[model samples]
Target: MRPAGKQPLQSLYFDYPLFEFRQPPELHGGDMQHPVVIAGAGPVGLTAALALAQQGVASVVVEKKDTVNDGSRAICVSRHSFETLQQLGAVAAFLDKALGWTRGRCYYRDQLIHRLEMPHSEDERFLPMYNIQQQYIEQFLIDKTADYPDLIELRWQSEVSELKNSADGVSLGINTPEGSYSLRGNYLLAADGARSTVRELLGLRLQGDNLPGNYVIADVRMAHEFPTERRSFFESSGNPDATVLVHRQPDNIWRVDWQILPGDDPDDAVRENNVRERVAAILAMIGHEGEWELEWWSIYTANTLCLDNYRHGRVLFIGDSGHIVPIFGVRGLNNGIADAVNAAWKLACVLKRLAPASLLDSYSPERRGATIDVLRNAGKSSRFMTPPTRGYALMRKAVLELALTQEFTRPFADPRQVQPYNYEDSPLTTPEAGAGEFTSGPAPGAPLHNCRLDEDDYLLDHIGHSFTVLYFSIEARPSSELAALFAQLYQLDPACCILRITGAADQVNEDDVLVDASGRISRAYDAIAGTVYLVRPDRYVAGRWKSANPEEILAALRRALGGSKP
Candidate 1:
């Protein structure tokens, strides 16, 4: 089936659009600089550009490739990612074509041993995971960039050859199809892949361990009736002594990842006949005897590598350029998207002079902390999926064998799906006044839980791309003094949204307020009269309070913005 928002120009599961590369003006005239220059046009870079545009920040995105990604790489999209996409105005395009699923099953020796169900409720707008090709993800983000033509300039087939950075700005030597040109920007964000050219130019190296185990991910087309759910197999008859993962994608394509044993040659694993034999064994073992054709396949190794620092001078590294995590937990693309959002918002605030330049310093710490956390958890999953030593292998085998009969051992088979990182230790997070009092709501540095307002409307729909204040008003309208306080906060930052949640629909007629008629949102946020939550631009709660004190809220906002002068 063709993806939404684009016409099919090719005959495969999706169309690959070849973007045209235009001549640069620097070839014939003087150099031109941009507010921000982004390297690479992959999903991460494009998402950064879109996120920047959401804040009215302009950027120039350069890509070495002329078309989208070649294969169905990085097919899993997390709900937190969907929330970021919604802020960038590109979620509808994704929801149109991506397959959503919440359930996963694990099998050991062809026997079902464990099941995984990510947290989901009717109040949530998106599912736990969505399966779609990376090409579609890139194309959808590219399509959204068209809406901000004046802000985003996409340069295709233009690669970064030389780079120089200083405290003031960054300069790059860009090589295009026509010739070479020099460009400048106040800041450079590197969203390029793991083998980033910018990272190399900056002489930064990724520091981490590359866990042992080689897996070949292959996508095949067939008319299988299996539902869209993640399924993992351990020590199955298909491969005898390997771990395999199966995921159903759109357009009737199935993605199968089977491990290659230690003595197996990585090159020979992708041979047509070898792949066919292994795939046939896997399909037969899973009771799928239908005819299938191989579409694409690639070799992947589990690694947890990242840079010590994400920022160098005026150049900031994001996505894979900043860190690389194990693929076992589907943290690659999702983590990159998170990096893009985090960097874009902070950079935008700095550029707009809304916050001090020190705000950018927090990027490396927050994101690097997240990377370290992923490495820790994914290291466990990687070792579990592919035991490195003989003793570990034996332990894993015993766990699987015992898991078939013991209920407690069954949890050992769980993959421990990826979850959003809490930035409680972040410098921007303000300690709550009565933090110990609230037991149910999102704490400082945690993401707000979405609440369903109606069948179609959700809490996230009301969130904006700025600091938001969720004020709970018990009366029909806030006191005159509290109303004056809201006006004062608005005067501090016009972009700031002070959304008053009233208990009754007729309490307020202002468009800036939300009516919690059903009290679902109140319960979700654990709100009472005068309770206030200060939400950052990235949707993470910065601070919350039981009483809506004006000075405390102002201090929290300033602290969240790097203590900038009001």
Candidate 2:
């Protein structure tokens, strides 16, 4: 076998199984089988599996958990992720149980200081943010993939004990109930979560710091006389200082979280009497004397950490396995799910021999950059939730006070701060020089945008199957040669779409807009006349030119398609 540090292909193929030349049933006239093995069965893992399945790539998912956890961990699904779910054919199931939330209020000292409503339409690419449990999300994905033969096989109760990667592929030692078995695949994905055993086996370390505080979360049912439409944030007024976040579930149950006291024992914090007292205290603060019934309560520490590397050879990490941020911004789960979507299609391309092995390197730089931003936002939100110093407290109060006015609320209402993070310097991004002030050009290492192309249309449907070449020109028609070449390429491969623009266009404006879905075309592509942009499947700019040159554009396409240099 080749040494571990060598390039992926040499190492992977050095000691992998050799396939015999034979005709197979699935490949009646083909010669190769799809190659990808994913670890874990969580939302991230399932998302990766479903994305691959949607692309006709065969994969397998192994999970240690036997069944889904009936917990209310993740609640808010962002507009971008909502669009992704729709693509996976799981949006309908999620909408069935999700509660649409269009407004949020921030309270300081029992006074409503800021209230903002979402600026969105019902028929937009994605609806306003929805509040749904993670369990339901997983169930929907699992049900959606039930009939896809090309999809993954859910190996419940299967845990991966060890993983080894070489130049050609990956081999995993999975510990099953029956016995330990070795499985091989072209690439292995580690969506196994924060305490991932797969990450440890690969000798990769999670690099980041844990915050200096913790919070207590409880799932309880309360019969109260409060507005069910509004989510309540209550500041502490009693001993054992706390802030309570209360919101109603679709099942008529209330999800409540009480910020824990410093140096409090979590095990003892959830005792029957302690939970009762906490509920009673919250009720009293809200001026209600109703019956508060406790269902489940747990104390958790809100720690923020990120992995130094998301890829270790053929085994790539995604989701909590790569990064863990505080729950204040509700981005941890969302970030993980987004990572799955990013890595899934890329892995499929590599396995299908459509993209080069070096493409995997882009995964870490892209997702980690986004995760770092998530941590930063979560840190900021945590400070707002639990300000550390007097100065910070004063600033928080001022922002809230300003939010009370319409003039100040308009900026804060955008919620762009909590949107998906952008990638700024990834290797996958092509350099765009001398193209200024246009939105359609590519940024070398930037993350995708989270907003829709337009108010009425969704960006997800437009970007499907292959890379997109968005040409924005003020000229009446596209360059004939460029248009013909793109049309020929699309006719040869219907998986891609080449859209031409001139003068008046809807959805995007000039700027650096490159993302999988929901990005401003004008922002990234420089909506200037006669400009052509080449976007990759994951929605990053691969290359761009002032005007279309078929030869130069074809070379860039060849590079993106994993072809060797001329």
| Candidate 1 residue spans exceeding 4 A from truth | 1-11, 475-480, 507-509, 564-566
Any idea what lDDT model 2 has? 0.65
Whole-model lDDT per candidate? 0.88, 0.65
TM-scores of the candidates are 0.96, 0.79
How do the residues 114-200 of candidate 2 rate in per-residue lDDT, one tens digit apiece?
565665653356555777766677777888878685566777767788777987888777666666667777888898888888888
Worst 10 residues of 1 by lDDT: 1-10
Please write out the lDDT profile of model 1 over residues 439-518, one tens digit for every residue: 78899999988899887888888998888999898675678877787777676566888788878787556777788899
TM-score of 1: 0.96
